[model samples]
Target chain A: MAAGGRWRQTLVGFLCLVLPLVSLWYHGRARPTPTLVERGLMRLTSPAQHAMSGVVASLSRVFTDYVWLVGVVEENRDIRRQNEVLAGLVQDREQLRKENRRLKELLRFKGERPELQTLAAQVIAKDVSPFHRVLKVALSAGADDGLERFQPVITPAGVVGHVERALGRYAEVKLAVDSDSRIATAAVGRDVKGTLVGSGDRGDFLATFETLGEAVAPGEEQRPLEAGDMLVTSGEDERYPKGLVVGHIGEGPARQSDLGWVYPVVPSVNFRTLDLVQIVTDHISTAPLDVPR
Target chain B: MSALGQSLSVILITFFLLGVESPLLQELHVSSFPPDLALVPVLWLALHVPPATGMVASLVIGLIKDGFVMGVPVGMYAEISVVTFLVARFLTSKVPIRGLSSLMITTMLLSVLASMLLALLSLLFDPAFQGHGTVLRLAGPVALVSAPFAPLVFFVLDRTDSLFARSRQRDAIFGR
Candidate 1:
């Protein structure tokens, strides 16, 4: 701690600091090969360097696999949640598209015929047993809504039925395929006319085409009521609108039976698959139907 | 301990630290510029020993580092070690060497200064040195990370220096 020793210590530190810069300047100028001391120190430490490299590399793998994978698992869970949300959104989109198409068609059809005021109803249930062909309809009632007795019901496919009774919230319909259902009919591009009567839940769906008022005119297009001929309402019965599709001819030509020609007919609308229908609320008369006896 | 014994022990401790530094930093995924761990003991020697012995030890430790380092010139680290010892000794004199906390803070400060000094010397010496950009890029984060390791390294080196001191004391007592 004497002043001379302190001065010497300070001088030694300064000289030590100066020495390497001088060596660096010389090494830069000479580009000399490493000295014996440098090579000796390298030889001394190389084994330890190699050993630490091997040991620590193994530890890094453990950290990468075990610790880092926890984050990967969390990321995967987030992706799965995103996938579920996307799937539900897609399903809702498809449902909306279908409903949009259906509503657009209904609006167009309503515009096509403005004579009758219509009311919308969802087909809640169907009585498709052998004893009956009735449909249960739930009305989407408006503020001033009311369904009358015997309102003719129709769909985009064609005439479905007529309301048998209005039960305030809903109504039961007598489907066109029931035994008591009747409509004036004529086959397309044919010289014959008849009344289409239903067969009432019969097997094989053999219905209507029972009572022809006129025959094929002297064998002109001899099998006039051929298979696939469309039968449309003639409006002669004061029941359904004219030009409404009632049914189509069955798989065969009409039989020359005693009942003029017993041509098989199938209803245009498939009641089993029907979802929504419209009741022509003011079709026949606003005075209310007699629910024909 | 004798000055020769103390310097040798510093060299021995430095060899292991320089050996472990690269692989350990790589495994720890020390981002950006890796901290210069070889500077740790230079700081210790600066604070503990006489300026002469500490500076010599610093030069030898830097020379040992020259063996492991790839791009740097042979004597550059030797100069860095000597200069770093001088700086650390100056700083600790101004503020007395206290606890591990102060040692860690000083280690961080010294690390950044040493890095800057390295860059400056490289520019003056090695014409191809472009790592002046790295010091600017890291903004001395490598120095920050180098701080935590100081306390542990300081603990180990302190114990080793004390053991040497005690062993020499027993030798003096036995009159050998």
Candidate 2:
């Protein structure tokens, strides 16, 4: 290589290494949006990336829905049995539902949760890196639609996560199963309350717990939390609504820690097939939420 | 092919791989850790291309990686990837790996190194990052899983590169 060429290469290499270091330091200082350089470069390439990811997701759907049917027969049988039982319950519930609606009409009740306004959104993209579990949601919304950043996002099944960033027509939701996610939660009927945290473990959504409220009594023999024990949002945490399902205790003995035994929580949202979610856009009052009787 | 052609080709390949890598791994039921296919292109460039070109390729690949995932700091992966590439370029220039076994070993070691660097960077950048320790614990396992994949990935990249090269070379031969 010529002297000038060698000089240019060395300078380029140095700049490449130094530039990222500078970026890391800058970002660590504060929360910021993409820099102009990053935005420009991303604009040039994002279309292609988006197209490829869409195609790949379609292919994955094929593999998941059709190619892998290992336990379909057993699953179908189990569902059929459950469906018969559910059918009976549905008939009984229909009678109760009619009576409840009639009573509500007499009382002039509008709805159970009129205070909490929400807009629906569908999952458009998922963060490809396992470490960063962010989902891109295509909102049926606009800036003036009462949607804002850091609002609680949920599905009918349970809590999906919270909106980390909200732009026009789209928002980024940080999953409840991500290591960075934290939610205030309590055991459904037990005195146990704790902060739910995701471990970001592979294969499943297994999160850890930190005891927060009243401690277990000293004298009595305490039963270790077991599998399928339910947890719900305590409403103590400002981020999510109180009483929303967070997760359930996982299939393992409660993990013992200095504070007490903390069990693994299996999040209620089926992240693998998470198709739609609702963002709780309207801010709630400071007064404790009253669950309808 | 010219320098720009090779560079553009590598960039596109990296982007596509980043998009599909996780889903493919999930389909394969390899949930323990994702095999680092991103490393393959950088490795190939390091081994085959000139140092300046390799460095540029690594930087571009790193930037793509930074853009590939959300919730991760933009420059974290970019810096780690560039550093990893520099190390690979330096080592290969010194010792010069020949066979698949050697390639596999180098890849495995580099994978571990990159993971450790990633953990360290995460710790520095994210105050709430609880997964750095977990990342450290899983580094060996991830490296072991990723090592065998290196040779196969390299083979595909090599075959693809040579296929185009052969077509170009045929024109030269016919003209000569």
Q: lDDT (0-100) at residue A254 of candidate 1?
A: 67
Candidate 2, after superposition: displacement of residue A31 in Å? 2.1
Candidate 2 clash pair list? none
Q: Give candidates' CA RMSD values in order.
A: 39.1, 8.4
Instruction: Encode model 1's per-residue lDDT on A1-293: one tens digit a residue.
Output: 99999999888877777888876776554232344544464455545555666677677655653454454456587776576567657766986898888788788888866776888887644441223456656676452347665568998777887776444545667777766677777776665678887775434444768656356554444465677888877677777766677778888666665546778887888765577788887653332121111
Off by over 4 Å in 1: A1-11, A29-41, A57-293, B166-176
Q: How would you encode candidate 2's per-residue C-alpha lDDT over A1-293 as one tens digit per residue? A: 89999999899889889888788777555343445645554454444444554677678755654456444577596776576567647856985897576445423321444556677776766665556667767665353544565688887667888876555556668888888888987777677788898777656777877665255666544654567778888878777877778778887766556676677788888887776677888646442422221
Listed models, DockQ each = 0.15, 0.41
Q: What is the fnat score of candidate 2?
A: 0.46
**Candidate 2 positional error at A20, Å:** 0.9
